[model samples]
Target: MSNTPSQSQLHNLAQDIKQWGAELGFDSIGICGVDLRAHEPLLQSWLDAGFHGQMEYMARHGLMRARPGELLPGTLRVISARINYMPEDARCATTLEDPTLGYISRYALGRDYHKVVRKKLKLLAERLQQALPELKLNYRPFVDSAPILERPLAEQAGLGWIGKHTLLLNQQQGSLFFIGELLIDLPLPMDAPANPECGKCTACIKACPTGAIVAPYQLDARRCISYLTIEHAGPIPPELRSAIGNRIYGCDDCQLICPWNRYAPVTQESDFSPRQQLLQPELLELFSWSESEFLKVTEGSPIRRIGFERWQRNLAVALGNAPYQPRIIEALEQRQAVSSELVKEHVDWALEQQKLKKDQEQVENRQKARLIRWIKKALPFHA
Candidate 1:
C-alpha cells in the first residue's frame, strides 16, 4: 500500500474506470484535469446578472463552483460520468400538446436521479480504490448534489459539449442523461474535449417556452419554467403562467425539439421508468390529490422536494390554461377557498382564465347561431 503507480498504470486505471462505469449503468465516462479557472469569469458574470434567480447557492459558492480542488483538496483528475435517464415511451410531444394532461419533466417521472447516478458513481470510485489499494487513493462522488459546475466539467471531460440550452449534449446520447463527477487524486490521462456539434442549429433556443435561454449558452433562470415551478418558492409570475402550459413540474421542451435527440437511447434502468400515475396524468386527477396523497405518491421522487403547496400552485396555473372544462373550474374554485395566499393567488388567476375561455366560447357559439339563421333565410331548406 506504499508504491506510486507508473504512467502506464494510471492510463490503465482510467480505462478501467470507464469499464466499471458502464457495468454500473453509466453510458459514458471521461477524465479531465480540474483547471476551470477559464470559466470563473463567466460564472461571476452570470451571478452578477442575476440570471440564477432565487438560487442563491449559485452565487454563495462564488468561483469555488469552478474549482474542484477547493471542494476536495488534492484533486488531480475528475472522472465525469453520464447515465441515460430518458425512459421508454416518454411521449414528450404528445403530453405537451394535451393541455388536459400534466407534463412532469421526463427526468422526474421516476425515482430521483441524484441517488441513482451518485450510487453508481460511488461504485465506480470504489472500484478504482480497490484497484490500487496501495496507492492511498482519495475520492468523492457528486451527482448534481454539490456546488461544482457539472456540465462544464462533463464537457471538458469529453463526455459531451454544452449545448445551446446550457445542458450537456453528446453526439450519441444527446442531452437526456444525468451527469456525475468522481474527483480523484490519481493523475490519470485526460480525455480530449468534445468539439461543438450544435452548428447553426438554434432549435433549443427557439423551443424554450419561457425564453429562458436568452442567448446561446446563456440561461436566464428567472424566466425558466423549471425554475419557476421547482426552484422559485414565491408566486408564479402572472405574465409567464400561461406560457408554462401544462407543465406541473419541470419542463423538457428544448430537449424534445433537439435534432440529435433522435439518437437518444432509452434507459435500461428500471428505476428511471415513468410511474403510471405521473406519466401524463389528467390535470384534474393530479389537482385532486391532497397534501398527504401528494407526499405519498411523490415519495422517493424528485418532485417531492417541491411540497404540496407549490404542487397545487403549479397545477392551478396549468388547469387555468386548460380548455374551459367545468370540472377544472370547479376544482380551482374548491382549492381557492381553502388555500393559502400563495395557492389562492394562483387559483384565482386560474379561475379568471377559465372565465375568459368560457366567455370566448359563448361568443363563438352565438356567432355560429347567427350565421346559421342567415343561411336559412338566404337559401331555403334543401333537405
Candidate 2:
C-alpha cells in the first residue's frame, strides 16, 4: 500500500511536520537521526559517580535512555519539540526573596506538563500519518515519562544546546521550557545542533543553594534542592535543610540567576498559567493544608507526585529557615504528634532552629544592654 518517494518529497514532508507542530501549540520542533551513542558514556559516568541520588529509575534505565532506536523499534528519526512553561503571573524572584512565601518552581505552578506535552506530541504524530498516509507511518510520543535522555535528544534535533546547568537552552528562549519527542519510522532530513551560547557564565553554578552543579554540564542531583523537594521521599538531609529556604516544591535559583533568561517570554500556552493558591503562597498557609486540601489544590499539578508526607517535610524545613516567628514555632510544634516520623523529625528540627533564634536574640539584647550602660556611664558627665 506504500510507494517509494524521492528525496525531495521526503524533505517536503519534514517541512510539513514542523508546520503541523506549530499549529498544535508546540513552540518549536526539529528532527534528527537516531545515533546518540556519544551521550551513553556520560550517563554511565553520572551513574558510576552516584550523582543520580535516590532515583533508582535512572540507574535501571541505563544507556537505553540514550538509544532512541533501541527503545522504539523501527525508529529512524526523532522529532523533538519544546514548550515554554514559564507562567506569566509567576513572581519567581519575588517569591524566592520572601522567606515567608514558598517558592515553587515556575514550571510546576501550572498543570503538569507531562500530560500537556505528551498530548500535543501524540497529535503531531497523528497528523504526520494522516498527511502521508501512503507510507503507513508509525510513531511513539514521549514526554519525560520513558527511559529517554530528553535533553540530549532535543540537542541532537537542533532544538537547543544543553546548557552548563544540564538543561536545554535556546539562545532566544533561554531554558524555561519542557521538551517532548516523537520517534518515528520516517527518514527525515536532520537539523544541526544549536550553537552553545553560555560563554563564561557561572551564574547557574554560583546560584545553586546546595552547590549541586559540580562543573559545567554536570549536576549532582543528590545535593540539588529540586531533587530533594520532589524526588526523594525519605527525610531530607539535615545539612541541606537551611539552604532550602522557602522552596517547598522545586528550586529555580539557577534559572532565575541566568542572564540569558532576561528575555524569557511568558508561556503562550494558557495551560501553563499559575494556579491561585500556588502563586506566592505563604509557608504557614501551605503547611496548614490537610491531605485532602493538598490533593484538591494540586490535582492536575506536578506537586501531587511528591505526596503529602514529603510535602510536609519540605514545608517544615522552610519554616525552620523562615525569619523566626512565634506563630511559625507554634505551627511546627503542633504538627509533630499528627505527622509521620519523617515529618515529625523535620518538625523537631524546626523547633530547635526557633529555639536557637530565641537564644541568639537574647545574647544580642544582653550585648546591646551592656553597650547602652557603657555609653551612659562614659557620657554621664557630658549629659
Candidate 3:
C-alpha cells in the first residue's frame, strides 16, 4: 500500500475504480490516455464559426478545452463515467406531443446534476487516493463544470460514440445519461473509443426543430433550443420562437428521435427522478409563477440557474406557440404589466403571436363554413 504500484497493479486499480464508480451510482466507467490533439481542430472550427453562441466560456479557455493535461498538470488519464439519467417517470412523448404543456428537458427534471455528479466523482477520487497512497494521486473531478471536451473524452474512454446531435451515445444505453470525468495521474489500462455506428442515418439532424446540427458531428448552438433556453441571456430570437414549440426549457427532440434511445435504461438514482412540479406542467401555470414562486418551485433543480426572468421569458415563448387560448393571452398581458424589461419584450412578442393565431383560425373557420355550404348546394338536390 505504501510503495509505487506496478503496471499490473495499475490495471487492477483500474478495475477497482470502475467497480467503485458503479457502486457510487455511475452506470458505466472507462479509462483512457489524455491526448486530444485530434479533437482540437474540430473544437477550433466550431468556435471559429461562432457555433457555441453566447457560451463565451467555451472560447475563453482557447484550446485548454481540448487539452486535459492543461487543466490538471500530471494528468495522464481521464476516468470517464456516465450516469443514466432517464427518469423512470419520463413522459417525453406525451409532453412533447401536447403544445399546451410546457416540456422541460428530462435531464433537468431531477436535482441539478452538477451537484450530484460532482459529489460522486469526488468520492470516487478519494477512494482512489486512499487505495494508492504512494502513487501521487493528484486528481480533479469535473461534472459539466470544467471547460473540458467531456463528450470526446468520454468517447476516447470507450464510453460511446458522439452521435450527430453531439451527445455521447452508448450502443447499449443510448444517450440518456450524464458524463463526468476525473483527470488523474495514473497509467490506467486504456479503453478504446467506441466505433461510430450512425452510418447514413440523419435522424437527429432531420429531427432538429431549429437545424442546430449543421452537419455530422457539428452543431450550431445559436439555433439549439437547449442553448436558447438556458445559456443565452438575452431575448429569444423571434425567428426561432415558433419552432421552439412548447419546449420552455431544453429540447430533447433530437434524442427523442434517435434510434438508439429506444433501449435507454431508466436511471437507478432517485436523485435523478422527476419532481411532480417539473413534468408536464401547463404553459399558463408556469407563466404565472412569481419570482419567489419560481425559486421555491425550482429549488435544487437545474432549472433554477436560469433564474425567474429566463423562466418567464421561455414560458412566454411557449405560451405564444400554444393554441390560441384566451387565458394564455390574458396571462401574457397581465405579466407584461409587472415583468422586467426583458420579460416584457418576450411578452409583447407572445401577445402578437396569440393575436395572429386567433386571426388565422377565424379566417380558416369562415372559409370552411363557406366551403361546406357550397358543397351542399352543388351536390344534393338535383344531382
* TM-score, per-candidate, Cα-based: 0.98, 0.96, 0.96
lDDT of 3 by residue, 1-383 (tens): 23657889988999999999999999999998888899889889889999989889989997998899999998889999999998888988899899999999999998999999999999999999889766667899999998899999999999999988889999999998999999987778898889988889999999999999999988999999999999999998899998999999999999989999999999999998899988989888888778899999889999999999899999999988889998988888898889999989999999999999999999999999998888889986743
- Enumerate residue pairs that collide in model 1: 1-134
Candidate 2 C-alpha lDDT tens digits along 17-50 = 8999899888899998888889988999999999
**Error of model 3, residue 148, in angstroms:** 0.7
Local accuracy by lDDT, each model: 0.92, 0.90, 0.91
Report lDDT (Cα) of residue 39, candidate 2: 93
- lDDT tens per residue, model 1, 1-383: 24768889888888888888888988999999999999999999999999999998998989999999998999998999988998889888889899999999999999999998889888887788888877677889998889999988988999999999999899998899998999988889999999999999999999898999999999999999999999999998899999999999998999989999999999998999999999979999998998999999999999999999999999999999999999988888888779999999999999999999999999999999998888888876741
Q: Can you tell me which runs of candidate 2 are displaced by over 4 Å? A: 1-4, 373-383
Show the colliding residue pairs in model 2. none
Better candidate by TM-score, 1 or 3: 1
Query: Which sequence of candidate numbers ranks them by lDDT, best first?
Result: 1, 3, 2
The residue-level lDDT of candidate 3 at 140 comes to 97
Among all candidates shown, the one with the greatest TM-score: 1
Give per-model CA RMSD: 1.1, 1.6, 2.0
Weakest lDDT window of 10 consecutive positions for candidate 3:
1-10
